[model samples]
Target: MDFFLMVISGAFSFYWVFLFTTHTYLLLILSQLTYTDQIIPFELSTHPKHCLSVGTRSRQVRVPRVLAIEGPGEANARAERTWRGRVPSERQVNARSLPQRDSLHRYEFTHPQMGTVFRLVMYAESETQAQAAATQAFAAVDSLNASMSDYLPDSELSRLCNQSGNGQSVEVSEDLWQILKLSDRFSRQSGGAFDATVGPLTRLWRRARNLKEMPDSARIEEARQMVGFQNISFKKGQKIELKKTGMRLDLGGIAQGYAADRCLKILRQNGIRRALADAGGDIALGDAPPGETGWTIEIPASQSKEVTSSHLLTSLRLANCGITTSGATFRYLEAGGKRYSHIVDPRTGWGMTHRVLVTVQAPDATTADAWATAISVLGESGWKKLKRKHRRLKAWLTETPITAH
Candidate 1:
């Protein structure tokens, strides 16, 4: 089976932080990472639209129109042609040997964004070209963070959050519009298992985790009342209306995925096909590395073993898709004699007390990232419910969320 839930035997935290600059980036640090020993075919599309959005609603919005970098005109220019990278034929591939003439070199560069180190790994023939492309890609990621980050009070998302119950339709930029549209689709598919308008609830839970105390029931109920996808509505002309006055929107679940998608787009535009962009841990992969079957990923293996120098006991290989892991193994709160996962449930204002982890491989990071969170909240049933509609999607979990296929 392509999708299986492999229970992790240990606990690990994703604690990573470093100051960054658009100019200076991370050099390859081989000791910090490792690959999953096994390899599997990622047989998937490599087209470069860089868009993870699928199945357009006849009357709905499309991500194809703009990049939202420099108003509508710049977005139109970037959207000029759906860019894509082409994979080499089988004869041109040698899993055992590196490329011959062009001599593909593996390079790693990283910049800090969205609270984690965003790493970029790729094979390129020219270092100059690769550097320029990486620079542009990181820039794109920063631009997205500026637009979507709720932490930045002046960010577009923050400004939009202030309008939660203004009862006025606000026209958002292309980037914001596209992600919201995608969020709406996911919200509908998961039966409210995922909601972007859980800002108020998220705040309460964040404070709870910070204080190592349970939030008051009265406060949770009040916040829960403001959390619902139904409170927000999309309108024509790329506008959105927040039906409730005190509502807030949060894209924490999907921002990394969306950022990964955008970076891949920038990479592809620069003719860099064999690429991988990791936003925190949410990764978007391109064509397999030259002469390689797929990228190797180190998957967590045991719950009984204590996490030390290496927590990953097994590895898996994949290509041409996005993959991410979301779980209670790392972030959580312990107060009042019970552990609470950092992944808060929108339906309830409390952090999930269950110890579970979900990993999803999808067509793009945006899809993988969002679904991972939804599945964690929805548990095993979420997989069974949405698998039929998302046949191409594959998932693995640290808990028995899905029986082995």
Candidate 2:
């Protein structure tokens, strides 16, 4: 659930399609051209069966009827000539119409592994080629998800978690190794603000929220014992080991961003230079659309005091970069009048209660995603410290106004 959705091009363009969770919904704005920035809160059915397909609908293309040719070589030559230039009016007698040459072909589909709808809008000569490229990109995303997801017991990450204990080591896939390395680096860089070893605390908070009861302080402290980046070790040849027995890895924070980057890479491999990969709102951009500097991303600000809902705080036109937002505006638990965000502070083993939204922009999606989660937990003081160290990192923060009873 997001308080605000990221607007790609064309108002509610390619990225607007999302699969809602049972407890969460989305705020979708209709065409900005027509509505003047009005938002509609639409609750989607949580049933796995329901999926929304968005983006430009394809127009029917009428292929030109070709006459019989004598030989294969002659037919090939004639086909090449036909594609290069216009055929005579007599040859065009049966030609109907072709898709607009300059039009962009967008293919939207739900990722099988992630269970989230992703849009791949590409500039291609034909719909067939666009669909092919989009399919390849989704396949890339699925491969990454299959390896990184902790939800699946047999996933590579889970396999590593199960093998790690009592100073034991286990060799992992290259993908897992890369993500683990990143998690370790960010954990150290953020002063424990970002940690993949926070899985135990995450599970505890998740269970507590599910039962609508806050976890006891004693239990949270106990879980903290099993969590620490220093407790985990990574070696060459993609080997990883958790020094503690109960340590686990949760890539929820940065895995999607990595996957988005991979999807963009795959699209480029298929000759799609201009594309956008919105992996559940963790966006990675390729070259911008034709004639534009970059893709416009709408970052939602807090709802105005006069308004009842959220709107775009600002818009960023970005090219060849990644952007991610972390906030408690959605998917938070309210217990005893305190709002706890889903993000947990690894150091304290507790969910963050501060109502702050943090958006981070980075050279890549993985970095952006991890930093966004880390900065959200760090709050203003911690973020200032981090910014002092990293001058190039760009961020935006919006805090909810605290009200008195």
Candidate 3:
């Protein structure tokens, strides 16, 4: 039952719509201004929900609704022109309604992918610095996506996928190699639940999902034969190879976390002290802002529409820690009145039967990301196994009621 819930949570969709606000003088002259040190008090309303107070920051800025950059290397067209168009009107309303502060400045940026929106919040020492940091963060996200996404022909993942697996080792970047090594360790520790070598199985299930049908049992068994951590061979000096030609690899499960980690690195390197990277909920936090407890996360309940609780975790303050949640709420196929999740159990060569949501917290995004998937596959037994392997890692498993809530 615990395992079932972990699986459901691991794949559930948690959507966030962030509003950023900036103050203009037109509202100040109108005698309807809320001002304090140049910062504005704005109310952000999200679709299907609303957040109140949520607290105030130095400045509030929203990303102009723009066309979303689609799959790798697409033209820089407007992603959402309507949203962009609405920004001015919204800005005016916020300017008229909200109070302003002198010293506080807020800037926001949004990117759409992974079935949800990604938001970044920046509060800088100066308005110029705030805007500049927000802009840099947005560009960094685009660059990070360009580097990590499957869209780029020259992406590390794309190159790794095309490499021959004739038992001859291929050299990869330290970053990619670290991800692979961490994946391997998780694979062994989770009893093969988190194998990166299950790329073949993932591909198969992806096709099944598109078809909205269960895969052929015989074919699934055949794919299972090729899916195992044992099939991958790794060596020193960042070399790796698959033993079988038909075997494949997919980092979709962990790439977001890795990218978040990389983004965090970039932010720190650029001397930005306090920042949060929300790569579709594979969040990485840098130093916490003064007087802030930590990043506030909404823990969604089994029902997709509601959040049962909220957690303000200081765990992000610990260097190198990342959080990943996996569940079966999104990306599933239903056939003959039965639903199969997209997360394939490599050991079984089939989609997971359990409905579980698993949230794992670990030292890095990569580890947390992979472990969340792996431990979900392991179910309760996998949970026990992971406890032995990673004493520092913590997990929370939530399951759908056999009887509806």
Candidate 1 per-residue lDDT, tens place, 259-310, comes to: 9888888888888888888877788888875434567665565554243424
Q: Candidate 2: count the clashes.
A: 0
Give the backbone clash total of model 3: 48
* The candidate that achieves the highest TM-score relative to the unseen native structure: 1
Better of 1 and 3 by lDDT: 1
Instruction: Give the range of the ten consecutive residues with the poorest summed lDDT in model 2.
Output: 47-56
**Which ranges of candidate 1 are over 4 A from the true structure?**
1-102, 301-305, 308-314, 399-405
Off by over 4 Å in 2: 1-107, 301-310, 399-405
- What digit string (tens of lDDT, one per residue) describes model 3 on residues 116-183? 45555544456566556656655665655554555466876666667645657777777667777878
What are the models' TM-scores? 0.72, 0.71, 0.65
lDDT of every predicted structure (CA atoms): 0.70, 0.69, 0.59
**Number of backbone collisions per candidate, in order?**
13, 0, 48
